[model samples]
Target: MRIALGVEYDGSEYCGWQSQPSGGSVQDALEAALSKIACSDVRVTTAGRTDTGVHASYQVLHFDTQAQRPMNAWVRGVNALLPDSIAALWALQTTDDFHARYCASERCYLYLLLNHPVRPGLYHGKIGWFHQALDVERMRVAAQMLLGEHDFSAFRAAECQAKSPVRNLTRLEITRQGDIIAFELRANGFLHHMVRNIVGCLIYVGKGKYPPEWMRKLLEGRKRSDAAPTFSAAGLYLAGITYDPKWKLPHFVEPPLAALLPRMSRPGQSGCNMKIR
Candidate 1:
């Protein structure tokens, strides 16, 4: 049978999502617990591969297993065996044609930044920090240029193995509240470090280092060297994935941090917090 699972993880402790020869990967840990439960080797495939120090609120994966255990065994039982930083949130028996990666129609990511003079103490490694003041309106305006289909080679990493640099970015929304800024993006697909690179350029515009129109120029340049440096991975989150209606997957998976922030408020208001959707 084919089993699909919703995973949430703190990528801070692992070497990224994929398994490596050195063995400190989320996949390695999950497969170990799954192998123990199945009493045999079991391989799994994911919707997307995240980089080191990145986090995921909702990650989907599937494995072909003949163990025939209860659904709870794959969820609660596997979570019990996994470390505190990793978990299998839900499990379901899926159709033979369902694939975690190819079946995804779109992927969403959220990047959080603490734009304050003081560095974060309590939320370190959970958010990106910028000491200088930033103009959210400028950043928002700059981000809109990235919408629609484009050759995004300027934002892609050098080591990215994707066959093409073209991608259709559907959304790029920026909002701020009390020194906290959230960048939410949705796309048909993303190249390696694409989001981070875009964020870096946006930061430059936000800080008055560049005009909002520069974003379009960089996109047209199509050279990685023309863009700003990649932003920190700590603030990035694989927010969720959208699949065909036939799969019946949840629309919002709710990152752990989302629960801790306030639901509504204006920027600079006292005790204001925002959730990236």
Candidate 2:
């Protein structure tokens, strides 16, 4: 049987989302728990592979298990075996055709900036809080330019192995709450490091380090060097994934992202809007 698992994790404790050789990872931890439950090794496929120190509030993965375990059994069993850093929020029975990665119709990411005079020890690993004060208004203006189909090569990490860089950025919004600055991006797809790199460029603009219009030029330029530095992975998270209802997976929603991004009329779906922030 196929099982879909909704996972949430604090990426600070692990190497990354994918299984690693030298260190621990969300994949390694989850696989360990699943192996214990199934009494056999299980390999799971995720909707996205986040970089080291990147977090996920609602990441999805699927694995094929022949154990005939009940959905609640898999959920309770995995949670029992897994550490506090990672969690299997829920498990659902899925069709053989349902795939967590390939079947995903959209992916969303949120990048946070701590704009203050000093970094708060309270949010040390959970947020990307910088000492420099960010102009959230300017960042919002700059983020709007990225709200359409484009070749996001400039924002992609050079090490990214994706075959293409073209993606439809359905939404990009910047909002501020006191010292917290958040960049929310939704897309039909994302290239590796796309959200972090875009946030880097916007930060430059916010700090008066780059022209406000430079982001649009950089997007058109398609040169990776034209973009800003890749922002810290601490602030980036796999906010959510969208799929057709036929997938039979429950929405793994989080409160932080729910209040930050614009909510659509339907759950686990996005509306067709191109207007930027």
TM-score: which candidate is best?
1
For candidate 1, lDDT tens digit of each residue in 1-277? 9998899888888889999999999999999999888989999999999999999889999999989899999988999899998988899899989999999999999888888887777677778888898999999999999999999999999999999999999999987777778888999999999999999999999999999999999889999998899999988989888898898765664445666445322235555445334
**Cα lDDT of model 2 by residue, 23-111, tens digit:** 49889999989999999999999999998999888899999989988888788888999998887888888888988889999888877
Looking at candidate 1, the ten consecutive residues that score lowest on lDDT are 260-269
Model 1 residue 114 lDDT score: 81
Off by over 4 Å in 1: 253-256, 260-269, 275-277
Reference-based TM-score, model 1: 0.95
Candidate 2 local lDDT, residue 87: 78
Model 1 CA lDDT for position 89: 84
